[model samples]
Target: MRRRDFLATCTAAAGAAALAVVRAGQCAQGATSEVAKYAAWRRFADTPFGRVAYVEQGTGPAALFLHGFPLNGFHWRGSLERLAPHRRCIAPDFMGLGYTEVPDQQDLSPQAQADMLVALLDRLQVSSVDLVANDSGGTIAQLFVARHPARVRTMLLTNCDVHENCPPPQMRNSINAAKAGTYDQKMQRHLDDPVYARSEKGIFGSAYMTPANVADAAIEYYFNPLVASPRRKAQLNRYLAELESNPLLAIEPALRRLKTPTRMLWGTADPLFPITWANWLDQALPGSRGVRRVEGGKLFWPEELPEVVADEARALWRV
Candidate 1:
């Protein structure tokens, strides 16, 4: 590539990355009990597609969690504590990114993601359960519910990348940027910037009750998947293609057909998905309970509003 062309591409990516974060907040200094309450189900290995690692604890009716992009179910640590005691909880790291490895041959589209999630439920003998999804997980959960309406009893969504309504030109630009080479270097450059780090305080901070956990968490847990620049390239390419292919046609058409009670949770401070997307989602789902507003919340409310999540889960499941 010509030097000028490469520089232009990098400039676009930097601009997209800058907009992606509004400002991250200062993380905390100590290990809170919220961090210790965490426990893992180990390598439980029974999935429709591949062996998956899930964090399972407490017992009652089942509640399944799907993690967002760039992070796995580990992001839902606080959500587990809130929902578990009232009901059985299982949150899995989505394939190619978390504890779950990408299957030998699996499609990365939303439909395929939905199938993988249902397979996880079936292997665990979970016929139907409540679903909570944040960020990209929200997109996956929506696809899953559309495919098998009876399988999802309820859904709580955070700001996810839903494109049925035609996302902004910048979103597409960002996807293109992520698909380009030098992703690792580009992503690191952004992560270390104070302004970059300052933005999305809600995204990383929601998972931890304290700031230290957010800071010191292993790069493997926080960034390994993205560090796989090739995979990052593939994912971004697939994602953009999915966006262009009218990929959400299946899911979008099925939203109104969804019988599962839906509650979209939004972080008021999020910049990437933004509060406006919430309005778009509400209008798309004719009967959806509308996006529940969070005053100062960013994208990860399951951490910021664990009690609210627990309350809604109980009401939805009658636990």
Candidate 2:
């Protein structure tokens, strides 16, 4: 009970309590980290084309997420997780994207992508889906909606390709380079530098308003699979080469006639798919629920604004 002994014991107790508090904070933050999110939902299915990698969560009316070009199901990771509790959220990596295997002799055209998506849904026994799409996935979603309206319950199309504006002008250089067999080299430059990769005109630049907010894991999730092999590079090349404005162009008439209730969440500031395109979508499709413009939204609003996307989807389904 000496004074020095009691003081020493008190200091030790205080230090231990502080350590516990620090550890607790770390655990709380860790729960929402990129690794935790990526680990949450991962599955693969064998389709006719190849093995398709997807992330699925929850169990209710199916909400299938389709990602744009140069990205994969991971692009839908945040929104998928948010919507999972309410609906069955399925985000699949297409044949030439994400963790999916590419067919050797296949062209991977937009129609081919449409068929592949259907096959994916069939393999999973998904009869009908509330389709949610962004970027180039919007183009393929249009094809699917136009070609097989019966299987689609409703649709949410964010910033993406419509009509002959597939790839838009900003994205043409990469596609043209891919045709000339130099895409891999071009992409490598951005892949090498994380900062440059997310810049305004970079790979994911136009996608996000605040590029620094993007997780390194999200970027790697899209790049690692495609960059792992030369075959994947070729597959990506075939995907780009097939984008001649024909596939989506051919489906324009069907799109105008599409009756599946459609909603568009547009990023108004997106240089590639501006608000004008959103207006076009609203006017073109008779079934459109109309456009909801995000004032500072970019191409990657799903990543940047998952809650808004989830809220909009919930509203659509409630109707």
Candidate 3:
């Protein structure tokens, strides 16, 4: 079948199946259960990028979840649990973050991250997916759709890098720190003091809606591996430096022409990626269903608001 026809057919089938899907709240409680199983559930795929680390759940048609910067697949634990009944959910740690082991010379650019996704999906035998992404992962998702449109059945994007605003002005200092090789040191500080890590001055405070509610264990799981070794720290720095360039500019035309069904669920409180970019996306994509505002939500809200993610994914996928 033609790709467009396939997508249309899939949408219809998904809608029919969605009626039997469980309520988001009922499954949301299981999100924490997955957290404990994360280490034991973790699996690795030997891709050209490296031994890529990923976690999966559920069955049937695949749904791929791409997480934000410094976070791994664990970011999607809630969504995975909530949506597992409807789709095979897979979430992988990016090359420079989480538990993914990359070679010293691997490219960490946005384009390279997109290329890695292609390789990782191929290795998993998943030809296409319902693409769900947040933060930096949203940038890579745009690149993925532009470069491989046929591989995406639909998309659900949260606050993240958009065209021309790839490295948002607010992140200038963070990028500068990465260039100065102090980025890892800053992360070390957060790791050393979990109390401060969730403080208004720390990452969770700046990115999440409820900073103090963030657990210490989650903080360790997210930052520990990124600073585990000298090579890992250097890799993390390389990943941040790469965001300085704008890969989305060259792909704006492609995005404008894309037909993959997409929904932009943006966090209004996110200073890094404001709601304006979501408006830009609504105009850019032909298949856009329009933007949904997440009032008072921030960059990392997807982690804290999985039920919201699950609801939007089901809506976008017609399932």
Candidate 4:
């Protein structure tokens, strides 16, 4: 049997005994060549977390993709586009935020995000998989391995918190943001505040700043999600709650000890996660490389420059 089929068959059997019936089916589904070959809405049952939304495609060893704050699996479409041909790629929106909803879901903490990742992987019937995480996805990736070291094979960390010794630009903004009361209010202040006024423009510009490419779609696509619900203002408030944990300060010590093979991918022009941490991590984390400095992009490089992101990530993973 093919490696994906052989492993998936074993994983499905394990999942059947470990996960609920629905989830086992999804794992079976994940291993299903006909089903996973196309873009389809997928659901898993009995993950440690509640029900979830997932998209899967291709075949072979799994490559699980995770997104950053305020964005869902949609953020991974571009990256998946390139990878689906050779690898089985799965991307899911974080719980309570995306197409998946857990109204009573409390504790939107980083640890919870990590826990959910483990459950999701188990339900999908993937024993071990590489990860592609961006921003907070990067943050959650560490917690995932820290919590379930056995599940993560290797990681491609892009502009994320890999080094506790260094602080990225967004971490500073997140701290400044918490004081603004509501999540929306803080980011609003971030956008409106004079300190970031020019930077905010860059944030949008980085989305589509190539020569002769004047596109506003990048900015619109990102901002439209916030306005998704007028009442979502309450939903927006939850992200700021992360402040109570001081996740960055808390996780910094652990980053230095990560045993996973990691690739620090950064956008050279990223205002949020400046390229400085690349060097800091290189000096601190053994075997880590400051590969391609992402050229001309924003915090949302996955969408804006998936080819660049994938090309470098592919090189890093040697996929």
Candidate 5:
């Protein structure tokens, strides 16, 4: 069997084991329990924007992870745990997302998000880092590298937005819904129907090849923060609006000039960021390390293929 296929099988087996543990109510205290593990490594940092929550583990060279929209640092928890032995994995919830505090007048545009990431790193006393970004986090990472190339030692990008594709057509429906100010109504619709929420047609389903493979608790971690309040909902809308703007056009020239040793770990099945975007990124970012494809991988590959993600980062940085 292919490596990813073998890994996927292993994950399925582990999920079954975890479910058995959950049934026995034995997952509440063990360090090996997914629930306990996710709860343990969390911390809050006071940044200029607000309080940012991050899941940090291991210690050595820093591998800062940036997650896409509607998801937060929790998205990288699996990879962080897997890679903790070799690298310090720091996954922070971007401003107004995850457990981070949302300001009433927050500016969550990609550029602002990138700036906040830089500042957060500064406050943490991390002078340099290797970036691992996916989804909207990929957009933010690119912008971060373009604006502050020196701070990044290397970068690994999974499927994400680039250039005019911004939000991409497949993702437009959700973005339009958010922009139309219908976040609450739509979110409630999912909350009301657990079956649909777990179906392939649901939020998690649309991104993951096997939605059932993801735990309900993990799904909650992605959606609960967005529906925390109307103000937070507005922040979500603001972030969607930024997607429509041609934000990357301004930085294209700088990106083409970048030489930061970039690597691509693309999910072949992602509708939003098709394989073509991987080619676009490989060429656009002159620091291109090359592209690595994950067969049957979808948008939320980090959540599903943590070990592969870690291997790619290790390959690029020689960690």
Candidate 6:
């Protein structure tokens, strides 16, 4: 090869490599900016349960987003950014999770979580909301719909507990640890080790699509407050232990009788809550529009694929 041709090819390769590096840096910067934005958006609403921490954006009819276990309002950060232009987006950290402050004797049962949501909406003067939820939040969403059928304008449910499958078989070990008062210790280990937090033994591996790709900053943001102190650790355990009871069984009748328009978005790959449960929800709810299968999506797909959440939500809300 000619010397001039060799030089030209080498220069071109270096330029391409440099451009790739710049693009990668830009993506990382964008994610960091999003995390910072969520931190800045945090606000607290005084409810009977506690000073409920939440993030709100946009201006229009209200839309409530409920997160999964061990996750807070930040779970819906991507969806919130996308849907803010269409409706008022509110995502609150439930008691025993995230930044919500609860009284020393506060109940962390699913029922209490549902009631806390009521208190929160009332505090915000939001009479009704387009509800969106995932994991344990979906369980609370059902209870909320059963108790206050008139309050939910429309519901969009992702992979979550349905009927008798409250805690699921896979979570039995964690619940047992909670019952034995060792679950909090396990959480502490996760907090101390980011690599483990994203490993097969931790939440990221079990719930997320790309466990290793999860940001360290996000892991800290989630687990830090949960294991912040002794009281916080106890509260975290209580939250898990409370899930042992089958609250959905009793609400089955009410769920069937419910007339609120609903949509189910299921992640087919989620082992904890299978697509079968989503189909069950579709069959049970009288007003169910149908189930939309998210192929290969795991339990926390809404966080990973916010465009899917926003698209389905817009279709359900008819906006």
- Which one wins on lDDT? 6
166 in model 4: Cα distance from truth in Å? 8.7
Backbone collision tally, model 5: 0
Supply candidate 3's per-residue lDDT for 27: 48
My TM-score estimates for the predictions, one after another, are 0.74, 0.87, 0.89, 0.70, 0.88, 0.92
lDDT of 4: 0.63
RMSD of 5: 7.6
Off by over 4 Å in 1: 1-40, 103-105, 163-168, 187-213, 218-220, 225-246
lDDT of each: 0.64, 0.82, 0.90, 0.63, 0.82, 0.91
- lDDT of candidate model 6 versus the reference: 0.91
Reference-based lDDT, residue 136, model 4:
74
Regions more than 4 Å wrong, model 2 = 1-33, 36-40
Models ranked on TM-score: 6, 3, 5, 2, 1, 4
The candidate scoring highest on TM-score is 6
Candidate 5 C-alpha lDDT tens digits along 1-319: 9999999999999999999978645422332366556767778888888888888899988889999877888788778877899888899988867788857897888888988888889888898899999998988998888888989999999999888888788767777887888855665556666568767777777888787666656656577777778887788777776777767878999999999999898889888888898899898878898999999899988788889988888888886
Evaluated at residue 283, the lDDT of candidate 4 is: 63
**Candidate 6 lDDT, tens digit per residue, 94-210?**
999999999878999999999999999999999999999999999999999999999999999999999878889989999998988779888788778878888888888878988
Candidate number with the higher lDDT (1 or 6): 6
Q: What are the clash counts of all predictions, listed in order?
A: 7, 1, 0, 0, 0, 0
For residue 126, give model 1's deviation from the true position in Å.
Answer: 0.8
For candidate 3, the lDDT comes to: 0.90
- Model 1 has an lDDT value of 0.64
Per-residue accuracy of model 4 over 106-159 as CA lDDT, tens digit each: 556777777777777778788898888887777777677666666777778777
For residues 135-168, write the lDDT of model 3, one tens digit per residue.
9999999999999999999999999999989989
Kindly indicate the candidate among 4 and 5 with the higher lDDT: 5
